[model samples]
Target: MKTTVRRDVLTLPVAPTGPENPLPPLRPPGDPHTPDERAKNGLPRDMARQVGYEPLRSLLPVRLLDGYGRKRTDTPLGTLVIENGRLRATVLPGYGGRVHSLLHKPTGRELLYRNPVLQPAGFALNGAWFSGGIEWNIGATGHTTLSCAPVHAARVTAPDGGEMLRLWEWERLRDLPFQVDLWLPEDSDFLHVGVRIRNPHEKPAPVYWWSNMAVPEERRVLAPADEAWRFAHPGGLRRVPVPVSDGADRTYPPRSEYSADYFFDVPDGARRWIAALDEDGHGLVQTSTDLPRGRKLFVWGTGSGGRRWQEWLTEPGTGGYAEIQSGLARTQLEHVRLDAGTEFSWLESYGPLSARADLVHGDWADACAETRARLADALPGEAVDAAYVAWLARADTEPGEVLAVGSGWGALEVLRAEYKLPGTPFDESTLGTEQAPWLELLRSGAFPEPCEVAPPGPTLVSRNWRDMLETAPARPLTEYHLGVAQWHEGDRAQAVRSWERGLERALSRWPLLRCLAVADAVEGHLERAADRYAEAFDDLCQERRDDGAAWTAATAALGREAISGLLAADRPEAARAVWDRLHETTRAEGRFRLVEAQIRYAEGDIAAVRAVFDEGFEAADLREGAEPLGDLWAAATGGEEIPARYDFRLRP
Candidate 1:
């Protein structure tokens, strides 16, 4: 049977991803894996010094996605399916173009975990990440900011002249355009994925890519190496023997007591691959071309906190799964430097492999050998390399049919730089209202201002856009955006000046006011920042229009920040006032419920704080390392044992 690609709908109970936070993420969203001095000293020479060598300063150009709640409803998510009668792969175009399912037709078994629900959790760098399937993480160490964002999708002819699903987007973080082409060869068991990342800029860019696959945790994961770089929560990295670590066989997810990352130290020149097989030695195997040399296993162990995290990421009753990932670097912490005008390309294959149950489940080395032998017999490494070569020839082929539309930022960049991206066209038609003002600035000399009442539009922080905004006529809107751009570029002094200038004639002062508040807090002016936050919230309330829904979301987002700032400044009454002003629905969200507990704690109402937790709540966007639940519990009960349900602490 010839490989076929078709559009389909994956209907599931999906939580609504509400409005994008209007605030620019002036701070790096908490990085759980940030290594400390001890961690830096603990690494092997290769990755030791390079830990956080080129980390993201902040999530700019991209706004935080903290809008999702625990509430879910039946939704039909758009999907694209490709099958060759032997293997079937389902891709969700709307959600990071994730490979949602991989089914082995002959055995009638699902290879990937195949998440039963589409629930957004606070895992992605910019928030809103769902568990399961294969997620293509690019641009940074943490989950890609694009996890919950859409990417441009289209149909293209594969190397074998079959229909291929191509998902491409201009990754905003690195200002690079990348593509992932998925196709299954006729009657072939393996599904081939060709990935390419192009740096069209004049300077070198740090590139990070990890194709993460979620497989059943019950399976024993096997990699080529015996030693792996282990990075765990509370921030430390150590090279430890694989399969066995901390007095236990670490390959089994349930054995570890805490969540961790095991980046396998695959020997140089080894055929790069990782597999997770059941007790019967039947499951998924992912093999990739040499360029993607890194392999990893991420486990949320059997501990209550780890299990709670699993439950938080998906439906409570769902079976747990672990991640088997492949990346371009030796480890996720280290980024490979891609030269200007050059590109990073590789091919990866995913399929099932069956081996002798005794050998697969026996000695560690034997199990690895058994899986490798089965993989070579099933689909040789030479075949994967040859497939990549054939794909490179067709990499530039223009897309035949457009499947889905992503953000217009790529098209905007293409227009700005006249990028000749062939297979993946960021056409001008993709441009929307978000790009309208910027388009005007690109064409006309002036930056058009928004309506006096409407909140400022999204930010554009690329150097090119920043330079443009710097030169444009300095109106309130122009200065407001200029401040954001300047802040993104790490020019704090200039950013403050720009925001302060914008506030001079700004009809809408909340955005600018909130920005200044952030600046003040960063500079250690806590009380001053709180005053600005209160004023900003008040301004937003005054500017709230008849459109209740939009305003409610905006108010909630700004209100949360305002309340937090107020509480930090020891202004409990002021924080309470902002809380009172929030919409009823907004105040009732799990995130705000936690905030309410904080407010009660600040007001010294220990009973009220305890009462808030008695009525259980889950902060959907609970940040990594910010344990409000634990802190609140301790404050309320005076060192009582933290309940298992609220305990998401990664460390003991």
Candidate 2:
């Protein structure tokens, strides 16, 4: 057992900050508590470092979860590497306490698809979620809002005379508490995993938890369930049979054209275990202790979208992998309702399993037998020895010294001493030197020249800036910026044209579609705006329709945007239709009520607008944030000024 604090990392500024620690950890005025209560890139005031929160739904799709909000001058980060007779485990203290890697020493196998880089792609909702290793999902799934912030980590001796890495955090999303204890029994092969979560609120909250494990692709996924359900990307559930879906056994990998992401439910009156076996006999099994658990598999398909996501998540070689996820109860869609302050806990054990070929297609009985055999083989001889060296993004810069490095899996690579590298010490530059300048500008919070778009106002922005740039940038981002700039310059007619072109390149970007719809409305293309807003709203609803309480807030904001977009274009009937559809799920939501009031005010129905404010919203309502709503209510009654821009801002 060893702990390391890289002094060099201390010199790395522009990260976490704390109060009374040189850096002010300045939060916006009057906006103190953010999602995760917003831990800036700083160490916890106490030894038990707490993870930060993020917005339930972030407006900006930037990766702020990486402690970028924290000032580097505030706190120190460290890593812990623990090893025993046969297995080695590594945990990153600063980065969400995620288990970086688990190595089976005898076979020299990196048990997990250990990512060699800390490169974060703008994929996850709150951003800063990476591939490989294991990740913890609390609150509203999709890689927790605190996926990158530090969690409380402690090195404690297990009751069974083994080393335990105890990590815990107060997940702010639902005001719930979570704790994960990783125990490696002395001379044992498995890592005993224990998890406990408690809802602190007086009332019940919809709690979601998923332990996402990234393993090699094409691994045989074995579960006790006979029937599996494919979870659709937007947010729906369709039942699919085990080992096959549309003429393909998703469990066997080599994914479909797009992406194969779905949950495998444990059949009633079945055993509780999910295992994955690679072609090389070495396997990993996650077994629970009669707890309500479910399994999931995600294989990024072979299509352009799939390939692009693969490249985005990792530096090649560490490319293809599937996430063997374990959920608390059921799918992310139908999440379990955790009673207020009711402490829920479970224990799961994971270890190496090299079973016979015959057991590959067998049921739970045979799988358990093989797993037991593997565990028996894992127990060491009389002499039990422990202690090994592993690095936590620590690299010693020296030529050919046989560094026991890697992202804590194997000696992947090493940074020459004092060599400061971007990404992580484990990462090699994959986007190449050509993309370096573009990436640098993006990181510096600046648009890469062509992406310079001013806000919509009397001010004339750089319209069609891509055409003016000397380099002739070919990226979809170029068009996205061009469209924004054109729209800001009051050229909505041209902005719609540019955004449509941009959407062709960045097809998955929903925000672009939303912006395009707004531009269409501004250009008096009411029919186009109505149609586009409907599509955008559908897309948004698909992804977030079932994220529990989070959905309520998200849909409130989304409904307001959709309905307002339609109303702005003078398509009152179309706006009503959108409102009815949203009412199916987000019925009588406060934000929509605000939008309804605004619509009536726009229609010269002052009484209706006043009546809405008279029916006051609760403090917990999502519409409470826009304090200006009250003033808008007053204006409708008191004959005060009502600016049309307020509709676009949705500030009401």
Candidate 3:
């Protein structure tokens, strides 16, 4: 009985069920989003019920793909990990593919509250809903049609060459396909979450998404609002403002000891972010652009009812978790109507927030200042253009120096080295500082307000480059196919030119960096290729895009050839950097340790390279199980002929 030393990539592919994949003629009808009421949602009347984990029927485990692509007799455990040194996520594929736990490694504590047990509670919008972790609620007005349904899960690469855990489930209520891609970019302190909700119906379909984050109990919520409104369930709505004594201000550790459930559509806040902090200055920040249209805070307080509900929701002693949830339209009560064949996608970011000062006021202003200051330190010299500030403040960090430190593209050495980046100073970083008057014209970003336009209804999906580029000049989705078509045609040079044209017209840096990366790799410019990969990745970290599924996957996998070229050029350090970001950015499957050993070998570690011959044969990821490395090293040392390696070839 021997335990496997896992040094290879692991793949557990869960196949598609079915749908009329309408666009492609020679494609599988395996997409679940059909034109009929095939997948419907509702728990009818389940208010009086007890729900917990059953034997998990209907889904049987299959053999898993090991590092060497060999079939193992073991059944898949239904969990996948996508880590980017800064953030780590444990995906629960078995349980609706929600993030079971999210961790910020810099701080040993778990950013998400982890459950010791896997019991479902009856206190959900549908039949049952599990508490804790980050849940992507999509579909019906309730806790989402897929809130409790098992979702298909896979590892994916993001367009900017970052690694991601992709999870999708068909909305049972409205025959729609929804996916959430969780990205962990290297060195960047935030976790980027990209979501795409597709309406496959012939008529306009009602769809919505809410990213729910559950932190520990006893936390304050900072949802800055001059006026807050919640649906009165039957009749009218109420208007509540901040610092109200009536306990309507659901900020930080709730003011009321009783259960306080607050939900509002598009709160009046300058920034699209909500925060929750524990006693210890440590907290988690949830930020987005226009993806979320509402903010919600749920609290059961420390009362008897709260304790009882907690015990009912979780297993005994497991405790409970509060939610700082976001909505796509109005509140969860309002649905964004999407036309047939239309898809809406947006980027959301989550980062570990540890502030030196305590912002107990729970105002939006305080939340904005703290998060802006902290992230500005984590990512220095980034063109910080945010709203709420009358003007933009100048950055003390030199653009050239920050860009030279790789601008946090891919795996940043500065982050690994543990350095304090410059913060938005009071002198010139804030709106009311000395530079406040001229900040608006001086800032480089589009100062966006809390996009009040109704989704689909009042404001439908704007697929045009002109409108899309107004907010996102980093990755233009409107003309992405021009480059993708050329890339698929196997003419990468033309693809690069097309992307260049796209950049000139759209000002998207992602296509340009990726185009440069492929060209550099083809021209044997491994260093530039590596840099381009990181730069493209950095561009994405700053701003990511997922217009279509194929385009997004292609964007992430484009750097594969560059990584191979770097390794062939004997630039293992650069190769390793790409691999680090790749693992965090995409579901790139290949041998990573060989490149690691090559890195060690290049760094003057002969003993480590020599050890490959002894223990490396058992390694599953090797193309020939250590034979290729052995022969290559032998050729270099004993003057023997080098073997032909297909992976190292540079071709069209």
Candidate 4:
């Protein structure tokens, strides 16, 4: 079966229009009459009455099995309950009081419930004197009070007899909406209220909301990438990036434990928008609202997880509440400046798609195209100019006759010299400077062999060396050898550059490139060193071989040393695998028993490693051949520290 990737996009609906009617009134307060009077009036006479004469019967019963028992009534404000298996609130009705939205099972719905109304202590409503209301002691102003009202579907009254609009709908699979619109008095300064949502459903629903609310984390106000705005918070302030293209969006995943708060300002005429996109890019819900001239944008997302007010707002590991606000600071809703009589509005939409494939064909492609165009526009123009200069420089210094001369050496030398170039007297010291030119000549495909080895006279040797170094100043091979010499003489930086230059010129010439890498490793560029060794090893491994015992032994030894070096560099796991390969290769060809013992010891099989050494020692008769094995055993058994005694080297 084949696999496929999908995408999804969410779009918002148009805003509502026209002046809407005030919502319906809340239920009347419970009767305070005696059981007989209440019965005659057709009220629930058996309702349990609490202090302040508030009837608690409408609330869902808090059974002992439900974990609260009778004492459940002694909860903090806004506690929801289940009575007759229906969810309800336990707070007195109205602004100063709490209201609970209960979640019902089966249909997975929530029912709204209100507490008793509390008017000022001495205030009279209708014909009765009401003694229930919130008391505020402002300085010396004795007492100011507020009352609560019952909760209803369309309309509800605030403590001060102000009206509010409530829109609520519940469905099993669909999420519930519990929003209240507060009707502020023409001159009111500020508004505040506490809300609670109760969920009794078996499955948790994803709940989210946006409001003119502020929390610790500064609200994140987002707009189209083209919009310009500034972000402000305790973190300081900065102008927001106006994306010239799409696919640029801001995200604030739920912060598990961080305090955050900030505000954003949308310029007077700018439109501000915010959105929440789920992980798969599907199920996007967005809100766009008009901003008052000079109003700041506020956005926030909840950073914690848990049951809050009986509602699970976020998933256990990942969930948060986000809010996008318009304008800065809290100011008079009407007095706030605006361009003309511009109406401030918010747009929101939420829906699920059939699959992510829907988004890829729609939103994702558009976003990608926009991003590509923007990048193309931003690219610097000088890149092409730089390339043109580089190509011109290469053409100007093209090689001449020396390349042909070097190429003729192999044929000339084979005719006279019995021994070939490999027989040349080249050791570590001469390898860099004295012999570098010849090596370079050999490395350049132009030369197949060294200058014919003249007789061992001083004049002949000097002439050969001078000719090799002088012939190819432009060839990459000469510079590479000189670099190697500089490196051996302790001029490391020069060595590296020379090797790099050599690599650049001869990369397509694998043999020379591989040799330069080897030189680099010998100069303590360990990473480069390992790379060179690997290249060499790969080349050797690919060639079929038999009967070349010395060559095979030398190659295996090199592999062993490289593996050890990797181990000492804190790559034990990688080194172990390399060592395994080395062991198999060496064992297949019947060589390096001591190296095999070392491999076992390095792999942490100390006992078996020691036995190998012991056997080798005994077989070699203890005196003449046992010394190395004895030392190996000592290192494996912790009698001697390996690195300190050996400096990670082995005698050839």
Best by lDDT: 1
The segments of candidate 1 whose C-alpha lies over 4 angstroms from its true place after superposition are none
**Per-residue lDDT value at 336 in model 4:** 19
* Residue 253 in model 1: lDDT: 83
- CA shift of 297, model 2, Å: 1.1
Task: Estimate, for each residue in 1-652, the C-alpha lDDT of model 2 and write its tens digit.
Answer: 2322111122122222111111111111121112221122232232112111222322111112311221124343355665776777777656666777888888888888877656544333344556677777876646675566666555554545444566665464454556666666666777766777765455777667788888887677777665676644333346677766788766776646546466676765554566778765567776655554677877666654456456545555655877888887555443466676576766666678777756665554575467545544653211111211111111121112111222211011121122232212223322333234334433443334323221111111222222342133534555565665455444556766766876787633455677776666655787787778778777666655354543444444446666777776677766666676664435454435666776777677888876776675321112101335546755786845433222111111
RMSD of 1: 1.1
Cα deviation of 406, candidate 1, in Å: 1.1
Angstrom error of the Cα, residue 367, model 4: value is: 99
- RMSD after Cα superposition, model 2: 21.2
lDDT of 3 at 456: 8
> lDDT of each structure?
0.89, 0.53, 0.47, 0.29
lDDT of 4 by residue, 1-652 (tens): 1111111121211111111111100112122211332222322222122111322221110000000001112222322121222222222222222222222332343221111222111111111112211111110101111112222222333333333222221111111112222222222211212121223223443221223321112212223333333222222223344322123333232431222222233334433333233333322212222322222222222322111200121113322333333321211111111122121222221111112322322453354343223222322123223322332222212121110011122232232232221111111321323234344454552322224321110011122333453455635545544543443344557656765676676522333344455455555667765655555455445441443543444345446555655544445555555556553545443124555565676677888886664453211101110135447656777776432212212111
What tens digits encode model 3's per-residue C-alpha lDDT throughout 446-491? 3222122110000111122123223433333323433443443345
- Model 1, span 1-652: residue lDDT tens: 7899899888899998788887788976578878777878746665754455678988888888889998899999889999988998999888899999999998899999988988898888888889899999998888898889999999999888789999999898888999999978999999999999999899998899999999999999999999998988777888899789889999988888888999999999899999999989899999999998899999988787888888887887789999999999888888778899999998999999898989988899999998999999999999998999999999999999899999999999999999888888999999999999889999996899765466667888988889888889899889999999998888999999999999999888999999999999999999999999999999999998855556776788899999989998999999999999988888889999999999999999999998989998988888766677888898789999899889988776
What are the per-model C-alpha RMSD values against the true structure? 1.1, 21.2, 24.4, 38.1
TM-score of 1: 0.98
Candidate 4 local distance difference test against the native? 0.29
Question: lDDT at 421 for candidate 2?
Answer: 25
Clashing pairs in 1: none
